[model samples]
Target: MSLTDQLMTDMKVAMKGHDKVGLSVIRMLKSALMNKKIEVGHDLTTTEEQQVVVSQMKQQKDSLVEFQNGHRDDLVAQTKEQMAVLDKYMPQQLSESAIRQLVQQTATDIGAESKADFGKLMKAVMAKTKSQADGSVVNQIVKEVLS
Candidate 1:
Protein backbone atom coordinates (compact mmCIF):
# COMPACT_ATOMS: atom_id res chain seq x y z
CA MET A 1 0.00 0.00 0.00
CA SER A 2 1.03 3.58 -0.52
CA LEU A 3 2.02 5.43 2.62
CA THR A 4 -1.17 7.49 2.47
CA ASP A 5 -3.36 4.43 2.18
CA GLN A 6 -1.59 2.69 5.01
CA LEU A 7 -1.89 5.81 7.12
CA MET A 8 -5.61 6.05 6.40
CA THR A 9 -6.08 2.43 7.38
CA ASP A 10 -4.12 2.92 10.59
CA MET A 11 -6.05 6.06 11.38
CA LYS A 12 -9.31 4.15 11.08
CA VAL A 13 -7.97 1.43 13.34
CA ALA A 14 -6.79 4.03 15.82
CA MET A 15 -10.22 5.60 15.84
CA LYS A 16 -11.84 2.25 16.50
CA GLY A 17 -9.36 1.47 19.28
CA HIS A 18 -9.48 4.99 20.77
CA ASP A 19 -5.74 5.32 20.41
CA LYS A 20 -5.07 9.00 21.04
CA VAL A 21 -1.37 9.16 20.29
CA GLY A 22 -1.61 6.97 17.23
CA LEU A 23 -4.47 8.95 15.82
CA SER A 24 -2.71 12.26 16.48
CA VAL A 25 0.49 11.14 14.81
CA ILE A 26 -1.40 9.84 11.79
CA ARG A 27 -3.25 13.13 11.47
CA MET A 28 0.01 15.08 11.70
CA LEU A 29 1.60 12.94 9.00
CA LYS A 30 -1.39 13.27 6.76
CA SER A 31 -1.36 17.02 7.15
CA ALA A 32 2.31 17.18 6.26
CA LEU A 33 1.77 15.04 3.17
CA MET A 34 -1.18 17.11 2.06
CA ASN A 35 0.77 20.31 2.60
CA LYS A 36 3.61 18.99 0.46
CA LYS A 37 1.16 18.15 -2.29
CA ILE A 38 -0.27 21.63 -2.07
CA GLU A 39 3.12 23.28 -2.00
CA VAL A 40 4.35 21.44 -5.06
CA GLY A 41 1.00 21.48 -6.86
CA HIS A 42 1.49 17.80 -7.62
CA ASP A 43 1.06 14.49 -5.90
CA LEU A 44 4.20 13.22 -4.24
CA THR A 45 6.06 10.36 -5.87
CA THR A 46 7.17 7.36 -3.81
CA THR A 47 10.58 8.94 -3.33
CA GLU A 48 9.05 12.28 -2.41
CA GLU A 49 6.82 10.63 0.15
CA GLN A 50 9.80 8.90 1.69
CA GLN A 51 11.67 12.19 1.78
CA VAL A 52 8.78 13.86 3.54
CA VAL A 53 8.65 11.08 6.12
CA VAL A 54 12.38 11.32 6.72
CA SER A 55 12.19 15.10 7.13
CA GLN A 56 9.38 14.73 9.62
CA MET A 57 11.28 12.06 11.54
CA LYS A 58 14.31 14.35 11.71
CA GLN A 59 12.16 17.20 13.00
CA GLN A 60 10.61 14.93 15.63
CA LYS A 61 14.03 13.79 16.79
CA ASP A 62 15.17 17.40 17.11
CA SER A 63 12.06 18.28 19.07
CA LEU A 64 12.52 15.31 21.36
CA VAL A 65 16.03 16.41 22.18
CA GLU A 66 14.90 19.95 22.93
CA PHE A 67 12.07 18.70 25.10
CA GLN A 68 14.40 16.47 27.05
CA ASN A 69 16.85 19.32 27.51
CA GLY A 70 14.09 21.54 28.83
CA HIS A 71 12.88 18.92 31.32
CA ARG A 72 9.61 18.42 29.48
CA ASP A 73 9.28 14.69 29.85
CA ASP A 74 5.68 14.65 28.66
CA LEU A 75 6.53 16.36 25.38
CA VAL A 76 9.60 14.18 25.01
CA ALA A 77 7.51 11.05 25.38
CA GLN A 78 4.97 12.30 22.88
CA THR A 79 7.66 13.17 20.36
CA LYS A 80 9.26 9.76 20.83
CA GLU A 81 5.95 8.06 20.18
CA GLN A 82 5.46 10.15 17.06
CA MET A 83 8.95 9.22 15.89
CA ALA A 84 8.13 5.55 16.41
CA VAL A 85 5.04 5.91 14.27
CA LEU A 86 7.00 7.69 11.54
CA ASP A 87 9.86 5.15 11.61
CA LYS A 88 7.44 2.43 10.53
CA TYR A 89 7.42 4.13 7.13
CA MET A 90 11.18 4.65 6.77
CA PRO A 91 13.69 2.02 5.73
CA GLN A 92 15.94 0.79 8.51
CA GLN A 93 18.82 3.28 8.83
CA LEU A 94 22.38 2.28 7.94
CA SER A 95 24.74 1.66 10.84
CA GLU A 96 27.53 4.18 11.57
CA SER A 97 30.18 1.88 10.10
CA ALA A 98 28.07 1.16 7.05
CA ILE A 99 27.44 4.86 6.53
CA ARG A 100 31.13 5.65 6.96
CA GLN A 101 32.10 2.99 4.47
CA LEU A 102 29.57 4.23 1.96
CA VAL A 103 30.77 7.80 2.38
CA GLN A 104 34.42 6.84 1.91
CA GLN A 105 33.62 4.69 -1.08
CA THR A 106 31.47 7.39 -2.63
CA ALA A 107 34.19 10.00 -2.24
CA THR A 108 36.68 7.60 -3.75
CA ASP A 109 34.36 6.63 -6.57
CA ILE A 110 33.78 10.26 -7.46
CA GLY A 111 37.48 11.12 -7.10
CA ALA A 112 36.74 13.58 -4.34
CA GLU A 113 40.16 14.42 -2.82
CA SER A 114 39.79 17.41 -0.53
CA LYS A 115 37.43 19.69 1.41
CA ALA A 116 37.03 21.73 -1.78
CA ASP A 117 35.49 18.68 -3.50
CA PHE A 118 33.07 18.10 -0.61
CA GLY A 119 30.11 19.66 -2.38
CA LYS A 120 30.52 17.30 -5.34
CA LEU A 121 31.04 14.30 -3.09
CA MET A 122 28.06 15.18 -0.91
CA LYS A 123 25.80 15.47 -3.92
CA ALA A 124 26.85 12.02 -5.10
CA VAL A 125 26.59 10.50 -1.64
CA MET A 126 23.14 11.93 -0.98
CA ALA A 127 21.92 10.69 -4.34
CA LYS A 128 23.04 7.20 -3.38
CA THR A 129 22.13 7.21 0.31
CA LYS A 130 18.95 9.33 0.49
CA SER A 131 16.86 8.46 3.55
CA GLN A 132 18.91 5.36 4.35
CA ALA A 133 21.61 7.50 6.00
CA ASP A 134 21.57 10.68 8.04
CA GLY A 135 23.16 13.72 6.42
CA SER A 136 25.13 14.67 9.53
CA VAL A 137 26.67 11.22 9.74
CA VAL A 138 27.46 11.28 6.04
CA ASN A 139 29.09 14.71 6.33
CA GLN A 140 31.28 13.61 9.23
CA ILE A 141 32.33 10.50 7.33
CA VAL A 142 33.11 12.50 4.22
CA LYS A 143 35.19 14.95 6.26
CA GLU A 144 37.11 12.15 7.94
CA VAL A 145 37.80 10.38 4.64
CA LEU A 146 38.92 13.58 2.93
CA SER A 147 41.20 14.58 5.81
Candidate 2:
Protein backbone atom coordinates (compact mmCIF):
# COMPACT_ATOMS: atom_id res chain seq x y z
CA MET A 1 0.00 0.00 0.00
CA SER A 2 1.04 3.60 -0.50
CA LEU A 3 2.31 5.45 2.56
CA THR A 4 -0.79 7.60 2.70
CA ASP A 5 -3.01 4.58 2.52
CA GLN A 6 -1.07 2.82 5.24
CA LEU A 7 -1.27 5.94 7.36
CA MET A 8 -5.02 6.13 6.95
CA THR A 9 -5.37 2.50 7.91
CA ASP A 10 -3.22 2.98 10.99
CA MET A 11 -5.13 6.10 11.93
CA LYS A 12 -8.36 4.13 11.91
CA VAL A 13 -6.78 1.43 14.04
CA ALA A 14 -5.48 4.05 16.41
CA MET A 15 -8.94 5.56 16.70
CA LYS A 16 -10.51 2.21 17.40
CA GLY A 17 -7.86 1.43 20.02
CA HIS A 18 -8.09 4.88 21.54
CA ASP A 19 -4.39 5.45 20.89
CA LYS A 20 -4.39 9.19 21.26
CA VAL A 21 -0.68 9.72 20.68
CA GLY A 22 -0.55 7.53 17.63
CA LEU A 23 -3.63 9.22 16.19
CA SER A 24 -2.16 12.64 16.83
CA VAL A 25 1.11 11.75 15.08
CA ILE A 26 -0.72 10.31 12.10
CA ARG A 27 -2.87 13.42 11.84
CA MET A 28 0.22 15.64 12.03
CA LEU A 29 1.92 13.64 9.29
CA LYS A 30 -1.18 13.78 7.08
CA SER A 31 -1.29 17.54 7.51
CA ALA A 32 2.37 17.85 6.57
CA LEU A 33 1.96 15.64 3.53
CA MET A 34 -1.10 17.56 2.36
CA ASN A 35 0.72 20.86 2.84
CA LYS A 36 3.71 19.57 0.89
CA LYS A 37 1.44 18.30 -1.87
CA ILE A 38 -0.23 21.70 -2.12
CA GLU A 39 3.12 23.49 -2.04
CA VAL A 40 4.37 21.45 -4.99
CA GLY A 41 0.97 21.73 -6.78
CA HIS A 42 0.85 18.01 -7.51
CA ASP A 43 0.70 14.63 -5.92
CA LEU A 44 3.95 13.72 -4.24
CA THR A 45 6.04 11.10 -5.92
CA THR A 46 7.35 8.23 -3.79
CA THR A 47 10.58 10.15 -3.32
CA GLU A 48 8.73 13.33 -2.37
CA GLU A 49 6.63 11.47 0.19
CA GLN A 50 9.78 10.08 1.72
CA GLN A 51 11.26 13.57 1.76
CA VAL A 52 8.23 14.84 3.65
CA VAL A 53 8.61 12.05 6.21
CA VAL A 54 12.33 12.72 6.56
CA SER A 55 11.75 16.44 7.02
CA GLN A 56 9.20 15.76 9.73
CA MET A 57 11.57 13.31 11.41
CA LYS A 58 14.29 15.94 11.38
CA GLN A 59 11.97 18.43 13.02
CA GLN A 60 11.04 15.89 15.70
CA LYS A 61 14.67 15.11 16.45
CA ASP A 62 15.49 18.79 16.76
CA SER A 63 12.54 19.28 19.09
CA LEU A 64 13.59 16.28 21.14
CA VAL A 65 17.03 17.80 21.69
CA GLU A 66 15.59 21.14 22.68
CA PHE A 67 13.16 19.52 25.07
CA GLN A 68 15.95 17.52 26.64
CA ASN A 69 18.08 20.63 27.04
CA GLY A 70 15.26 22.45 28.74
CA HIS A 71 14.54 19.44 31.01
CA ARG A 72 10.98 19.27 29.72
CA ASP A 73 10.49 15.57 30.35
CA ASP A 74 6.86 15.53 29.27
CA LEU A 75 7.56 17.21 25.93
CA VAL A 76 10.63 15.05 25.46
CA ALA A 77 8.57 11.90 25.93
CA GLN A 78 5.90 13.14 23.53
CA THR A 79 8.47 14.06 20.93
CA LYS A 80 10.13 10.66 21.25
CA GLU A 81 6.79 8.94 20.72
CA GLN A 82 6.11 11.10 17.70
CA MET A 83 9.56 10.27 16.38
CA ALA A 84 8.84 6.59 16.82
CA VAL A 85 5.66 6.95 14.80
CA LEU A 86 7.51 8.86 12.08
CA ASP A 87 10.37 6.39 12.12
CA LYS A 88 8.10 3.77 10.65
CA TYR A 89 8.07 5.79 7.41
CA MET A 90 11.73 6.79 7.18
CA PRO A 91 14.30 4.88 5.17
CA GLN A 92 16.89 3.04 7.20
CA GLN A 93 19.52 5.51 8.34
CA LEU A 94 23.18 5.04 7.39
CA SER A 95 25.71 4.31 10.06
CA GLU A 96 28.62 6.71 10.67
CA SER A 97 31.14 4.27 9.21
CA ALA A 98 28.97 3.67 6.17
CA ILE A 99 28.58 7.39 5.61
CA ARG A 100 32.34 7.83 6.01
CA GLN A 101 33.05 5.11 3.46
CA LEU A 102 30.54 6.60 1.03
CA VAL A 103 32.07 10.04 1.40
CA GLN A 104 35.59 8.67 1.01
CA GLN A 105 34.72 6.70 -2.10
CA THR A 106 32.73 9.50 -3.71
CA ALA A 107 35.52 11.96 -3.00
CA THR A 108 38.01 9.70 -4.73
CA ASP A 109 35.66 9.10 -7.64
CA ILE A 110 35.21 12.83 -8.16
CA GLY A 111 38.91 13.60 -7.57
CA ALA A 112 37.94 15.85 -4.68
CA GLU A 113 41.40 16.52 -3.30
CA SER A 114 40.73 19.32 -0.84
CA LYS A 115 38.14 21.45 0.90
CA ALA A 116 38.04 23.56 -2.25
CA ASP A 117 36.04 20.73 -3.78
CA PHE A 118 33.57 20.64 -0.90
CA GLY A 119 30.60 21.64 -2.99
CA LYS A 120 31.27 19.08 -5.70
CA LEU A 121 31.92 16.32 -3.21
CA MET A 122 28.76 17.13 -1.28
CA LYS A 123 26.60 17.15 -4.39
CA ALA A 124 27.83 13.74 -5.48
CA VAL A 125 27.58 12.17 -2.01
CA MET A 126 24.14 13.59 -1.32
CA ALA A 127 22.94 12.28 -4.66
CA LYS A 128 24.08 8.80 -3.74
CA THR A 129 22.88 8.78 -0.13
CA LYS A 130 19.69 10.84 -0.58
CA SER A 131 17.38 10.19 2.41
CA GLN A 132 19.49 7.29 3.69
CA ALA A 133 22.07 9.56 5.32
CA ASP A 134 21.82 12.68 7.39
CA GLY A 135 23.18 15.82 5.75
CA SER A 136 25.17 16.91 8.81
CA VAL A 137 26.77 13.48 9.04
CA VAL A 138 27.58 13.58 5.35
CA ASN A 139 29.02 17.09 5.68
CA GLN A 140 31.28 16.00 8.53
CA ILE A 141 32.39 12.94 6.62
CA VAL A 142 33.19 14.99 3.53
CA LYS A 143 35.14 17.49 5.61
CA GLU A 144 37.07 14.74 7.34
CA VAL A 145 37.78 12.98 4.09
CA LEU A 146 38.97 16.14 2.38
CA SER A 147 41.16 17.31 5.24
**What's the lDDT for all of these models?**
0.88, 0.91
Best by lDDT: 2
What residue pairs clash in candidate 1, if any at all?
none
Tell me the TM-score of each prediction against the true structure: 0.91, 0.92
Whole-model lDDT, model 1: 0.88
Error of 1 at 51 (Å): 0.4
Clash number for candidate 2 = 0
Model 1 earns a TM-score of 0.91
Tens digit of per-residue lDDT, candidate 2, span 87-115: 88897888999999888888888899988
- Estimate, for each residue in 1-147, the C-alpha lDDT of model 1 and write its tens digit: 899999999999999999898898889889999999999999899888888888898899889889999999999888888888778888678899998888888877889898999899988988998788889888888888888
- Highest-TM-score candidate: 2
